[model samples]
Target: MNREPNAQLIAVMDEAQVSNKGLAKRLRDAAEQRGMNLGTSHVGVQRWRDGAGIKPETAALMAEVLSTKLNRRITPSDLGFFSQLTPATPPAPPSVGYPSTVSDALSALNGLAEEPPKGPDAGRLIVPDAELSSAVLSWMISRPDGVQADQPASQRVGMRDVHAIRAAAETFMQLDFKFGGGHGHKALRYYFRYEVLPLLNATFSEQVGTALFGAASEISQLLAWSAYDSGNHRLAHQYLTSTLRLSQVTDDRMFGARILSNLSHQANYLGNHAQAINLARAAIEGAKGKATPRAMSMYSAMEARALSNIGDHKGAGRAMNEAERYFERAESSSDPEWLSYFDSAELMGEFCHCFRDLKQRRESVQYAQRAVDDTDPRYVRTLGFCRMVLAQSQLLNGEVEAAVATAGLAVEGGESLQSSRFQRYVTDFQAEVSAYASNPAAAAFNEQVRDALARLDDE
Candidate 1:
C-alpha cells in the first residue's frame, strides 16, 4: 500500500520555475532531438501526480532528460517509490520452445525477422538456457574426432597439425554462415576447449606457438560471431572478450579489429548508437597502419553505419566517401580472398541503405539502382537489401505502384537468403507498405509479403 513519490517530480518543477506543461514541452523537445516523439499531455502529468507511475523505459528517459537539464546525474530512484514499480508486462515466450536444436533456433530467428514489432511487448522475449545447452551439445556431436599422426614423433607434429586445425576452423566458419551460429557454436567451443587449449598449453618453439595462437583466435572469433548472430548477446560478449585475449597472444591486430567491428554492429542493432559509434571508432583507430586496406575500408563502413543510426548524416557521408576510396584502391589489385567478398557494388549498396535511413530519397534511389545493376546473383541477400532501399525511396516519392513492385522484387530476393538480418530489411519495408493499408496497390503488396513470410515460417 505504499504510495508513489511525487516529491521529486514536484521539486524539479519548482526549481526550474516551470509548470507541468512547460516540463512536458521540454521533454518532448529533448526526445525529438534523439529521434523519439514523446507526447506527454497535461493529463499524463496529473496522473503522475496522482501516483500513477510511468513505464520503465519512459522513466529512464525522464531521468536522462533531467540529468541533461540539471547538469547532474539523475536516476529514476530519485523519484522515490515509482522507481520500485516493476514492469507489469509478462515476459515474452521464447523464440524456440524447449527441446529445440541449434538449427531449429536459427530457423525460428529467421522467421521472427518477418514479425512486425509487437510494441513494448517485444522486449519481453527471453532466450532460455536450455536452448543454448542443446545447441552446444548438437555442435559437439557433429564434429569428427581428431586424427592421429602416422609419422615419427620428431617431425610428425610440425606443419601438419597446424594445417588440420586451420582446416577445422575454416569449416566451422562456413557452417556458421550457412546454418547460423547456433548450429556451429557448440562444436567450435568444444574444439577450443579440447583441442586448441591443449595445443596452446603444450611447449613449442615461438613460431609454432604463434601459429597455434592464430588458429585459436580465429576459432574464438567464429564462436563469438555465431553467438551474436544467434541473438545471444551476453554469451557473444563473453566469447568476444576471450577472443580479444587470444588475439593479443598472437598479436593479431586485424583479427581483433574485425571482432570489434562485429561488436559495433551488435550495439547498433540494440539501439545503443552512441556506444556503437564509439566501439567502431576504437576499431578503426586500433587498425591504424597494421591492417590491410580492405580491412580499413570495412572498419570505415562499420563506423558510417553507426553514425547514420545516430543521426549524424554529415559524418556518415564523409565516412562512406572514405570507405569508397579504400574499396576502389583495393579493387584495382588482386584483393585478398577475405576482402574479396566486399566490392564497390556491395559498398555502394550499403551506402544506399545509409542514405535511405537518413531520408535522402534521391541519393538512396541512385545508389540502389547502381547496386542492383552491379550485384551478383549469388548475393541475393545484398540485392534484397538494395531493392528494399529502392522501395523505400519510391514510397517517399509518392510512387505507390513503383514502391509495391520494388518491394515485391525485394521479397522474392529475400526468400533465397539465409540471413535473418537481410530478411528484416524486407520485413521493415513491408511494414512501411502497411502504412498505406488503405491504398489498394499498397494493400496488395502488403498481403503478398505477409503470405510469403507465412510460407517461409512454415518452411
Candidate 2:
C-alpha cells in the first residue's frame, strides 16, 4: 500500500499542540503579516486536513510558515502530495449545466490560458478566421430604415425611440446572460446596426442625441462583450473598437470608462497582464471624479483583479481596499441604473479571486466566504465562483477532505449555472485534488469531478 507523509503532518500538529483552529489561526496571522486579511475558522483548517492542496507557490509560503512554527525546514513534500500536483483539464459544456449565456460565454473566453485544450476542443481558437470580419461588416450595413428623412430635420428623431431601444437592449442583455452570446449577440448586433444606428443618424437635438448615443454605445459594448464571451475574440475586439468610436463621438466619459473596463477584461483574458493593468488604471484615471461612486468602485475592482493576475499582491490589496471604500460611499449616493451592480460583496468576491490567483489561501477563503454570504441568490454565477475559490483555498491549506467537500459544493453550484468560467474553476479544483489520489476520499472526489466534467462533454 502506498502511504503518504501524513505521519509527519501529525507529528508537527502534535508537537505544536495545534488544533485545526490553531493551525488556521497561525496561517491567518502569517497571511496578515504579509498584508493579507484573513479569518481563522475551524472549517478553514479542516479543508487543509482533507487534502485540498494550495497552488504550488502558495504551498511554498505554507512551508515557510510551518518551518517557523515547527522550527524546522518544511518542504511541500512534507505536506503530502501537494508539490507534485498539476493544473486540471477544463470541464465540458454539458457538465457546466444550463444554457450558455453571454456572461457564461465571456467567462469561457476569459478562462482560456493558452494551455493545452481539453474536452471536445471544438470551441478553442487556433487561428483567426477572415469570415468573422466579413460577418461584422455585413451586420453593420444592415441598419434599419426610417421615415425620419421625410420629416423636418429637427423633428426627425424622438426620445421615445431611444427609450424603446434601451429597453430592448436591456432585454437582450438579460437573454445573453441566460443563453450564451452565440444565441443573442447576432440579434442584438442586428438591432443596434439597423434600428438604433439609423435613429442616431436622424436629426435630433444635442441633448437627445447625447442620450441616444449613450444608449447606442452601451448596446454596442454589450454586443462586444457577448461576442467576447462566445470565444470570438476577433469579432469582440472589432465590436469594442466600434463602441469606443461611438463613445468618443458622443464625448461620453462614463461610456469611455466602461469600454476601457471591457478592454481590461480582454487583455487579462489574453494573458497580457501588464496591458490589462495599464488599461484598468487608464479607465480609473480617465473617469477621475466624473464617474459615479458605483462606476468608480467597479473600475477599482477591475484594477485590483488585474493587479492580482500580474502578481502585484500589495497593489492588488490596496486597489481592493479602495474599491471597498468606493462601494461604501456608493451606498449613500444614488447611482445610475447601469452602475447598480457595484457593491461591497461583488468587490470582495473579486478580491477573493485575486487572492486565489496569488496563492493567498487563507485570505482567499475569508473573502470568498464573505462574498458567498453576502451575494444575492440571483447572482448564482458569482456565488459559484466564490465557492470554487473557497474550495481552492481549502485545497491549498492541506485539507484534502475539506477541499473535496468544498469543491463538491462548488462543482454542483457551477454545474447548475451553465457557466464555463465556473466549470473551469471546478476543473482547476479537480487538478488540485489529484495531488492526493492516494487518499481514498480524495480519489473518490477526483473520480466524481471527472465524471461530472465528462458529462459536460456530451452537451
Candidate 3:
C-alpha cells in the first residue's frame, strides 16, 4: 500500500540525535534487555520513517526508546503513526522502560505520576528473568558520579529541604502500613513528583545532595512497595528501577542493596522464584561489608522465601538459619531508619511463610503465632497476613474450630485495609478451607471472607 512519508518520525529521530542505524540498535537492545528478541534493523527503521506500518508491540518499544533517549514522554501518536494501527490491533501498552541515566529516571517518574499505567501489567518492560537480571547486574557494579549537583538547576536547596522530604516519606510509609497502599498511593506520588523531584536538580552542597538523593531513594522504594501492595506490579517495578538509579547517584551501596531485596520480594510474589533467589543473593553480594546485620538478615530471609517456594527445602532451611543468625547479631542503633520495620515480628513472619510453604504444619503454626502476637497494632496489614498464615497452619493440623476462629479474625482485620495483597491472602486461605466446606465453622469462615472481599471491591 502506498503511504505518506512519516515526517514526524524523522523529526523525532533528529531531535533525539540518533541515526537510523543507532535507533535500530537501541530498539534491538531495548527488546533484548527485556528478554525479547527483535530482528529490526536500519532498513525497518527507515521503512517506518517512510510510513510503513509497524506492529503494536514494536511501536510501543520504539516509543519507549525515544522517550528515554530524549528524557521525555513520547508516544506513537507523536511519531504520526496513530492512524496506522488497524481496528483488529489492540492499542499498544504504554512505555515504562528502564532508564539509562538519573535524568531519564526523573523524567520517567514524572511520566508515571502524570499518568499511572492502567490495568494489571500494562506498562512493564522487564520480565522476571532476563531484563530484571540485567537491570540488577547493572546496578551492582555501577560506580557513582562524584560531586553531584555541582551544576545545579534554577532552584536552590539545603539540608533542611532534604530532611523535610525524609519526614514526609516516613509519614506516608506509616499510612501505608496502617491503611494499605490504596489510602496513600496517589498522595504519595503527588508529593514525590511535585515536592521532591524538582529538588533533585536544585543547587546544594555535596553533603546536602547526598542526603537528598538518599531521601529520594527511600521515597521511591516506598512508592514501589505501595504500588506492589495495590496490585500494580508494572508500576512497582518501574519505581524500583528508578530507585536504584537514584541510590547509585548517592554512592550508598547498602541502600541500593536494600532496593534490590525489595525487587526480589516482588519477583517472588509474581512467581519468578529463581529470579527472586538470584536477586536476593545479588543484594548480599553487592552490600558486602556495607550492610548492617539487620539488613543482611532481611536479604537472607528473602532468599529463604524464594527457595521455599521452589521446593528447595534444605536450601531454604539453611538460608533461614543464616537469617536468624545474622538477625541475632543486629544492633538497633546500627540499623538504618528505613530498615526499622524488619524487627523480630517481621522476621518471625518470614519464618511463618517459609515453613508454611514447606508444609511443616507444626513449625508454621509456632512461627505464625509469634508473628501475629508480636506484631505492633500499628501494622494492621502485617497482622492480618500473620493471622491468615496461622489459620492455614491450624487447618492443616486438623484444628478446624481454631482455624475458623483465626480466619474470621483475619477477615475482620482485613476489612479495615485496601490492600489487594491482603485480599489475595484471604482468598488463598478460603481456597484452602474449601475441602472442609461440609464443616459448619469452615463454611461460615468462607462466607465471611467472601463478604469481606465483596465489601473491598465496592470500596
Candidate 4:
C-alpha cells in the first residue's frame, strides 16, 4: 500500500475513455453478473491508481468487460492493475445471480451506486444477459424477501412522507417525459440515496410499509429507465432487478409484470432473444388475471420484439395481434398511471418496429407514421424512437429521400431528448443508409447524419 499513483492504469483508462469510477462500477457489475457477492468501489480504484495493487481476479474481470467493449483481448496487465489484488474471502454461494434478501438487495444496489472514493461515478452502462434472465426468473418464483415491520417506530413517518416520495417520483417521471432520462438520473439517484433510503430502513406500520415498497418500486423503475436511456445497460439491469424484487415483496403483481416487460425491452435490444421471450412470457404468466389490459398489451408488445429478434415471424405476428387486442380492451379509469404510456400511439410504435424487423416496410411505415403523429409531445424520447423506425422503414421501401427527411426530423426532436439509445438509433440509421451510399439520395442522407450526430455528441 505505497499509495503511489499507478500511471499505467491512468494511461489505459484514458485511452479507453473510461473514468476511474466507471471502471470501478463495471467490475462490481461483472462480479454480480457472474453471481459473486464481491463488491468494489471507486475508493479501491483510487487506491489502485495511487499505486495500490488490484486483486488478480478483479483485474481480470475488469479486463473482460473492457475487452468485450473494445472488441479486443485485454489482460490484467493491460489495465495497469496489480499482478494480484484479490481479497481473501469466503467462497461464493451456489445460487442464481440475484439478491435473496433485503440486505443482499441493498448490497447489490450500493455496489451499483457506489463510486470511486474520490470521483463521481459516471458512464454509459448496460444489463448483462445472464444476469437479466437470472434476476427475472428468481423474482417470478422465489420466496419472499421477509422484510419485517419495525417493532418500535424509530422515526415518525406518516402518509406525508409517503406522499412526498410519490410526488417526487412523479415529478421525476414528468421531467423524464418532457426532457429525457439524462436530465433526471443524477437527481433521481441522489434522492434515492438520501431522501428515500433512510425511510426504507425506518420504522413504519404494515399499511405504511406496503405503501412505501410500492412507491419505492415505482421510483426505482424510473431510475432503471433513466439508466437505460442513458446507455448504462448493466446498471439499468441492476436497478430493474432490485425493483422487481421489491415488487414481489410488496405482492404488487401488476408492477412486477411491468418491470419484467421493461426487462424484455432491454433484452431484445441487447440481442438476448431467448431471455427477452421468456421475460415477456413470465410477465404475462406472473401477472395472469391481474394485469390490466394496458399492462398486458405492453407485455405482449415486448414478446413481439423478442420473437422478431429470433426470426419467429409467425410468433411475432401473433404477439402483435395479442398486443392490439389487449389495448382494445384497456380501460382508462382502470389503468395504473405507469401503464398510461402504453396508449394507441405507443402500440403503433411497437407495430412499427415489429414490421420493420419482419421486413414489411409498408406496414412498418403505416404504424410508424401513426405513432409519430399521435404520441404526445410530452413524451419526447418515445416520439424520437418512432421517427427513427419510420426513417428505417422508408429506407427499406427505397424511399431514400423520404427516409432522410424523416430522419432529420428525428434528429431535430432528439436534440431536446437525453437518451444514448436514442442516439443509437441515429447511428443505426446512418449505418443502414450508408449501405445505399451509391444512391445520390443515400449519399446526401449520410452527410446529414454525420452533421446531426456531431451536434448531438456536442450536447
Quantify all predictions' global Cα lDDT against the true fold.
0.61, 0.61, 0.80, 0.74
Per-candidate TM-score against the hidden true structure:
0.63, 0.64, 0.77, 0.74
The alpha-carbon lDDT assigned to residue 160 of candidate 1 equals 62
Better model by TM-score, 1 or 3? Answer: 3
Pick out the ten consecutive residues of candidate 1 with the lowest summed lDDT: 116-125
lDDT: worst 10-residue window of model 3: 84-93
Model 1 / residue 263 / CA error / Å: 1.3
Q: How many clashes does each candidate structure show, in the order listed? A: 0, 28, 0, 18
Residues 1-459 of candidate 1 have per-residue lDDT tens digits of 555447556765565566778667766776676566679877787667556767544565565566456543344544432433223343443332222232332233223233312322211123344543343233223332122224233332355677778889778766654444556666676666666655554556656666766676666677667666555555555455445444554556677677677767766764556666766776787767767777778888888888875557789989898887777667436433335567778888778767765667788789888998898766555677778878877876767789889888878766534454555455555544544555688777767777876876776
Which ranges of candidate 3 are over 4 A from the true structure? Answer: 1-98, 122-128, 150-152, 457-459
Candidate 2, superposed: residue stretches over 4 Å from native = 1-155, 178-183, 331-333, 416-419, 440-459
Clashing pairs in 3: none
Which pairs of residues collide in model 1? Answer: none
Error of 1 at 318 (Å): 1.9
Residue-level lDDT tens digits of model 2 in 1-459? 332334445655675677977777776776676555557577755555554545543444555566566543344544543423211221221221211232332233233311213322212222222332232232233332222233345446668877887888778766655544555766776676567766654787666777777787677778777666655555565566456545554455666777778767776654456666866787788778777777888888888888886667789889988887877777535565566555677877888878876777789889888988898656656677777777777776877788788777766655544444455456555544544555688777767777776775666
Q: Give a tens-digit lDDT track for model 4, residues 14-132.
A: 76788878988887887777566556888887777777765445665676666555543344544554423211221222133667777676666555555312211122123445665
Error of 2 at 418 (Å): 5.1
